[model samples]
Target: MDSKYCPDCGHPSSIKRIDRKYIIHEIEHVLHFERGILYTIRELILNPGENIRKYLSENRSRLVKPIIFIIVTSLIYTILTHLFHIEDGYVKYHEVNDGTVSTVSKIVKWIQEHYGYANIMMGIFIALWLQLFFRKFNYNFYEVLIMLCFVMGMGMLIFSVFVILQAIMHFNVMSFAGAFGIFYCVWAIGQFYFKSKVSSYIKGFFAYILGMVTFWIFPVIIGIVIDVVSK
Candidate 1:
């Protein structure tokens, strides 16, 4: 009879070899708070391009998966915003206008309340857009999504810190952070996908703009469809 192989450690396994120690170690490696998660977050923030390139080229076993990183950072962002009582300008605008928020405003508020999910949706849209815009690169949708997950996760982490500071300092810094995020996205794409800085910058600029427009327009289009269907 052939021996079964352990999928994780890639060694021959038997029922007798499965023990408490092995189970505990596996759980700790996969779910412990401090292992690869912190390292990946720091690398993503300090040296995103190189970090992403290394993950793409080298073994990814040591790093937290990009999707999990994005989700964790996004949850932290959401929690921080609530904890700090960070006021969104959109909400403030609607609050000041006749004390009656419109349907569009309501939609925007729902989107903001679920910002993490919205971000994932936007990431999908941007990935598709990039696949089309950079078709010559010949990268698949999943690869682009992996890159975007890292980029967006890093952006969210930076944005969350700025939000905390803005709350404490009583100054608006989100615009600055938003601008930096856009620039960082451009630089990351340039570093990973394009050989020429000039070409990458040009494409990244247009791609970012288009991404923003699509994100904003998508909700409006959906709202319109909903209204039409109800009527």
Candidate 2:
């Protein structure tokens, strides 16, 4: 009779069947209350570039998956914003039309309401500029995207902390949080490329701002095209 374990390997005889249960079990076991996200957070805080580099090159068992990390962190920020009524307009805009919802307006409102997914979109936008600025580096566009996933998630976490602080202290701190988030992102991007360089860090700063501007410009361009097509 054939054994369950591999005859030569002494592991599962065949590949273990992967189903929804397998996925759930992995998430539950790895991302348990004691570790997982918390450990990821700590590592990212300490050395985001080094940790992310390890994630790509070395074992991935340590940190949470980038996609999952961003989703979870964005959810935390979104929940806190709603819970504390923090209407700082992180991704929102005031009415621009005469009670008519334009394409850009709708998109902005959707992003405001769904930060978890919106952050992913925003990350892609940021990744474009990052790849452009850091083209000399070995990292490709998708690699850059993965890096932004972790970086932006950290930014959301930063925002989440400030939102909680604003709620408790009754002092507006979202702006400060925004500054810190941007600073961290720039530093992480710079570190990812240059071990130590003033120019790389400076470029990192511009890359982030340009990435944000580029993302914002997309909705406006779409809105214009829609209006032109309808007219």
**What is the C-alpha local distance difference test score of each model?**
0.73, 0.83
Q: Model 2 off-target regions past 4 Å?
A: 1-35
Which pairs clash (backbone N, Cα, C closer than 3 Å) in model 2? none
State the local distance difference test value for candidate 2.
0.83
Top candidate when judged by TM-score against the true structure: 2
lDDT of 1 by residue, 1-231 (tens): 555997779876865677998888876665435467777777766666677777877867656787777777777787888888875622233334877545666677877777667677778888877887788986788888888888877778877888888888988877787777777777777666763568876786677668767987887777667767866
TM-score of 2: 0.84
> Lowest-scoring 10 consecutive residues by lDDT in candidate 1?
87-96
lDDT of 1 at 145: 81
Best of the candidates, lDDT:
2
- Across 141-162, the per-residue lDDT of candidate 2 in tens digits comes to 8888888899899999998989
Residue pairs with backbone overlap in model 1: none
